[model samples]
Target: MKKFLVVNAGLAALVGSSMAEAGFSPYYAGAAIGASQNNGSEAQFCDECTGSKFTMHKKNTGAKVHKVYAGANLNPVWGVEAEYANLGDTYSLDMYRPEFGIPGGRAETARARQKTRGIGLSAKANHRITRKTSIYGKAGAFVWENKNSMDYTNLDGINEKYKSTDRGVSPTVGLGIEHEVTDRISIRAGWDRTFNTGKGDRFLELDANKNVTDLHSVKTDTDMIYVGATFNF
Candidate 1:
């Protein structure tokens, strides 16, 4: 009986130690720097028409903007984040209204240079899958700032400028893993996604006869891949 009691006590102590090692909480904050890809698509029409009334038509013109960013993460399980992503100059397909008959019988080419900066906040939840690894998903809001410049040599052999700063709310979802490399340090990696909102879309007018219009009613999604070192106190 005495030996059995001792064995049970030893097992209980071991279990307690394991639980201590797993140390989890409702709050944690960290910083991460990563590479992200912004993928967006939209359609356009004359404001008077409900996208169906326009004599000009283009189905789904899209763009892919790739960038690198650094940011801090705060986890209250319902917290906020501030990140800055720099997009150098990403290009995409620019279509025009084929129905509009031109004087020279030539279709205009539409193209431009674009860069984006994002500042945002989010809410997140963490699920511990193992002693040193966890998975998480997040959703939140953001304000994306866009700057666009256009070149319409096809229309007037001249350049134009169209710039605007718009406000938008975006939602994000992500998964993450944490591994303890030591008692004071750990390595973490995660992927996050965000869907952008209405004011997020902008239009560009190249020349009087032609324009490259952008309609981003459909949300733009961004994917992030990051690995960072963390300090636990």
Candidate 2:
């Protein structure tokens, strides 16, 4: 009876250890939503303004900030992940320059529709703090596309429409903490920012007369804070 009891105790210990270490799979997927801010100064032309006091927002149908990603765990500490971010939003900026137009110059209105989206792959490194929790950091390059349109309305009620597109590769970095909620599920909260984004700019055509004729140059960028969940397989 004593010998049988000793064998059973060893098996129990082995099973418990296995359960504790079995949560991380070779593959995983996750999704997150949070707030994103678009920090691009609105620039004006034709009716030339020195500085613009206007702001823009990234418009989304669901959350202000959203992202979806999937990755593989090469081992306990290293892996790779690919992500897609929806940074689409809109805003309008109106400026009045006392010296820009002649006497009784019309108000300048710019109704802007901005679109910013990105997809990229990153190398992730992990550090386990406990059996169920870990913290990680990643660095990668994202090929981001920025497409925007603006409708300029003059005081005289003359309107002009223009479209602009900008696409390039930008360096991205982020850090986060993740905890296992269930054996195959986990939750994470993180912040990620891309650097040196493109400014989708378009220009206006004006004669020497300096009339508020057509379109102009504009700028845009990306920043976000997110909380998300993941599933392992």
In terms of TM-score, the best-performing candidate is 2
* Model 2 CA lDDT for position 160: 82
User: Ten residues in a row with the worst lDDT in model 2?
Assistant: 53-62
lDDT of 1 at 163: 44
Runs off by more than 4 Å, candidate 1: 1-20, 24-30, 42-91, 94-110, 155-157, 197-202, 205-219
Q: Per-residue CA lDDT of candidate 1, range 25-60, in tens?
A: 323345666665545432321232235322332322
Give me the candidate number with maximum lDDT.
Answer: 2
Residues 1-233 of candidate 2 have per-residue lDDT tens digits of: 99999999999877656644945677999999887665554442323443443222323222376889999987778899999987655223434432254546546556655566889799999988887899999999988876656676666777887776667788888899999999889999997877655643533445567554443334444667899999988
TM-score for candidate 2, please give it.
Answer: 0.72
How many angstroms is residue 162 displaced in model 2 relative to the true structure, after the best TM-score fit?
Answer: 1.3
**Scored by CA lDDT, what does every candidate get?**
0.49, 0.69
How many clashing pairs per prediction, in order?
A: 1, 3
lDDT of 2: 0.69
